[model samples]
Target: MCLRGKQRAGRVQSRVHVDTVDPLSAVSDGVYRLDREWRFTYVNAAAAALLARRVEDMVGQRALDCFPEVAGTVIEAEYRAVFADGRDRVFTYFHAPQGRWFEIRAFADPDGLTAFIRDVDDHHRSDQRRADRVAQLTAVLEALPQATVLLDGDGRIVSANRRWTETGEVIRDAGLRPGVIGDSYLEVLSQHLTAEDRRIIGAGIGGLVTGGPRAADPPFVHDYAHAMGSQRAYFRLQAARVEPSGQVVVTHTDITERVRDQQALAWRAAHDDLTELPNRARLLELVGEALGRDPGRGALLLLGLDGFKAVNDSLGHEVGDELLRQVGARLREQVRPCDVVGRLGGDQFLVLARGCDAAEAAALAFRLRTALTRPFCAEGIPVPLTASIGVAAAQPGGDGVHQLLSDADTAAAAAKGAGRDQVHVFSPGLREAARWRLEVANRLRDGAVDELVVHYQPLVRVDTGEPEGVEALLRWQHPERGLLSPAAFLSVAEETGQLIPITRWLLGETTRQAAEWAAGGLPLRMSVNISARHFSAETLVHDVRVALHDSGLAPENLVLELTETSVAEDPTRAEDQLSLLQNSGVVVAIDDFGTGWSSLAQLLALPIGTLKIDRSLLTAAARLAAGGSGSVLTAIVSLARTIGIRSVAEGVETPAHLQMVREAGCELAQGYLLARPMPAADVPRWASRVRAAGGDSCALALRGRAH
Candidate 1:
């Protein structure tokens, strides 16, 4: 075939002469030929179909004239380049008017160029969909808050988001390589990681990328800390396999703030807010650690501040708090470098001395006690304080931290009981006593108050020898140990906070009994002992009112007796509650008046209706009366009478005792000399018998002395 070109209207045109049967016409793919002038010289049937044009009409046409949109486009450029270089060109193009994609290959000959085209619309659309998906994925990665990177099946970094790039820049100065496209991700990780970290990260990421045995498992995660310049940062790395493609999507989330917050929380949890010392929980933890190291070679010193309540009450709680802080500081100063001091809450502290024996612990305890004895100044006021320290040296095969603390606490209790400002070492006896106290406290908490019964000892009018009133005494009807006295459990009850409930029950039971007696024509005044704990609870007045209202007992007929120590513990609360009760017509009495350290002025300040002379004072007076000097007892009675308070002499066990009280002008007398304490059921029988014998029970007893 021969081809010629003609110039027309500044464009090149071509003419071609072909044989009757053209070889190019038989091709299935569309075929066309362009001459050196860039004009179509021939078009086949397939080319006609792909180009959607007639061969006859396109034969003499310029390529740009036939497809005008190809002007100044990639198709025109490719054809020109083929003609110039006489080389083959292959490209894909879209025929906009035909609305189809086609793959074309052009070959340049000396005289002209021949082109082959094929319809590729479906293939092109699929490839376009994949590209769109890749673009969408890139957008998603860019929008994520965490630093993210995508890796190929070979573990090569394919793409990374802006955050990843920024983080890489930030960590580059810390000897880490910045993640770059097409770089091996594991290689980049190895730049800064230790051998161990490198191995772990490589295995985790490599398994996901290479579809190893662990690929089917959940995402791999790791947490690490990095120092960025002067600040430390924490990051959690997460690597997840992208299904089917064997690609991995790795993410790093910064958790520095969360880590800092957690650390702060841990610190606060382990330390006391006020004293800045390890608190109870953390102290126990440290003690446990110490014991774990050497269970038989350590000791714990438990210190309880003696009379701290009085200090807190006398001064304000602000000053008390300052005192506690100073006390903690002093304890820290006194402890050895290897030892630990911690607060066990209010007015209590503990020292953990590892490698200390019993003798060493006792010496340390004495030293600590001496240190506390030094005065402290709180809120500009000088305050003297002392600690009762209990030493518990670890025994071979001793129990753990809790048992050690318990032992030390028991010893401290013994020390305090012995007196304030004393040091005591723990022994087996103290453990037994502590166990008994614990058992008693537990039982009292578990409704053992119901096992209690009241017994009344009659108080008689000294002049008439007639029963006028009775003092209620508590007796525990123990299922295991017969009847027990108050001395056996009352102290434990007070310590365990069970005393308030016991007092509540006492009020109810005593008031009900007193009302019943009055209803039965006995008409005897009832007395109940109140505890200091009730004052602390601020519930004494309410408790009394409830009892009186529930039992229909006249308030005037019920007397509430308090010890001097009970009133002194929290005197403001006592005064407030007592004033309210006295206003409500309930009589108040100070029981065992001579035994406590209450001053006469302190006594006169209260709304007193009577003073019950303690047995000690009465006995001392009787002995002195035999020597012709009963001045103290006589003065007490005269003072009570002067203040309009009736005086009752307790423990009048002899005829001489009764005579001594009578001569001293006491209005009432109650003792074993007349009658012992009897049950509520026996009180009526006893009263009836005394009345049947002409109502002179005391005279009947004294008739033997008179004879």
Candidate 2:
């Protein structure tokens, strides 16, 4: 059988040879033969069906006529080239009329061309979608802010953004090969990164690439520091796999600013703003760390500046601040090389001495105290300062940081109590005392004023032996313990700010009891001790007025007794308040006169109606009476007499005391010999009994002094 076509010259041409039944008819692909005239000479059954035409009708038809959409297209050009060159050509073409893609293979023969055609629409569309996705991914990668690179499953860079290019240039100068397309990202990183960083990065990215069944794995992230010349730069690397494609996208973001900000915040949190020393929180942490290593090897020195409050009050706070700074500097310089000096807030400093025992700590504390006592010049003036130092050697099996601080603080309190410019080592007794103080302060703060009761001690005239006034003393009836004297808790109250309320309560109670006594024909003047804190509060006058008004007691029947030290604390304020009270007919007496550092001039300048000589002076005067050297007591009493101010001799416990005050012309005296401090209910009966006994209790006690 033969296939023939008409040439342009109108002559018959043999295109292909075929079997009688056309063996190409069973092939799945469409097979056809065309002549040089571009006419179809033979079409198999598949070709006829693919062209949607009958083979008998299409056999002699021209291809352009059957499918004119192929004209002026690459399919037509390739077909013509195959014919001219006599070469075989394979190409894919879209037939617009059928809206389908087909792959065509044309073989040029001497006479004509035989073509094989297969439907390839699915393959073409799939390839087009993949190309579009790659283009979109490239666009997204270019738009990223951080340096980014895309890696194929083989760990080779497939694409990178502009930022990655810039970063690569920097890395190239650091003796590393920059990552480019087809380069391994890990290989480039391994050049400059540490071994650990390389291991971490490799594991992270590798896991994502070959994750297989674990395709939902979280993205890998790491932070690293890189040396860029003289300075350092920090970066966070993040890598995530592209799903279904097994490709990984890696990003390097700079985090240097964030890291530096965090560091600054941490520093400020731990350091003091004024002195740049470790604050309380940081000091506790340091102590804890030291104790963690060797709990019994170290010691803590707590130094509190003595008379700091006086300096702050007398001079301006500016000068005081300068003094504190100097003190901190001195402490820092005085400590050992291994010691850490830190500020524990205002006017207090702490020294951490490593590997020191109690003896060594005490020695260091003495040195610190010596250094602190030296005069500091503030604002071109020499200001004297001193410190009370406490030494607490770290003990094994203790409560650690807080316990150490507490022990040191207790020791410091003991030193201050002993005297300024002193050092005290911690002891178990101090701990017990500290616990008692804490209990007292806590109870006082928790409304313990109700447990307070007043006891009255008579102040009698040394000349007439008649009762003149009663001094009110405070006593605490503890729930657990027995009645407590003011000596046990008054100092703690003053330190804890519980003194003012206690004083106010005392005033009301004493005034009310005095009014009751006066109503019962015993009209004794009430004397209540006032604190310096009251002068500072400026509510002393108002509190006194309220007490007197509430109790219906005459102002003349109330006496306010203040220690000379309390008055000297703020002399101007004390004078102002005391002058007003004196004008109101309330007697103002300076209690504990000789015990304070106040000069006689300051004492005499105040509007004092009476001076209660301190017990120590009376004891000294009695000891020196036989030697005719009791001039100090006689001088004080004579001065009071000349100034028209009454005198009361305190601690008149012996007949000698009573005789001395009487010969010294003391106006009044009170002691255990005459009558001890009694309850409020016992005061009226006692006063009446003293009045019935010839109104001379002092003389009666003197006459019966031997018993």
Top-lDDT structure, candidate number: 1
lDDT of each: 0.87, 0.86
Off by over 4 Å in 2: 1-134, 174-177, 191-196, 309-325, 377-382, 628-630
Q: Tens-digit lDDT track for model 2 on 396-453? A: 7887888889999999989999977889999989999999999999999999999999
lDDT (C-alpha) at residue 136 in model 1: 74
The parts of candidate 1 lying over 4 Å away from their true place are 1-199, 214-217, 227-231, 241-249, 296-326, 342-351, 355-368, 374-449, 460-468, 492-525, 533-559, 570-587, 619-631, 654-667, 684-707
User: What TM-score does candidate 1 get on C-alpha atoms?
Assistant: 0.67
Please, what is the TM-score per model?
A: 0.67, 0.81
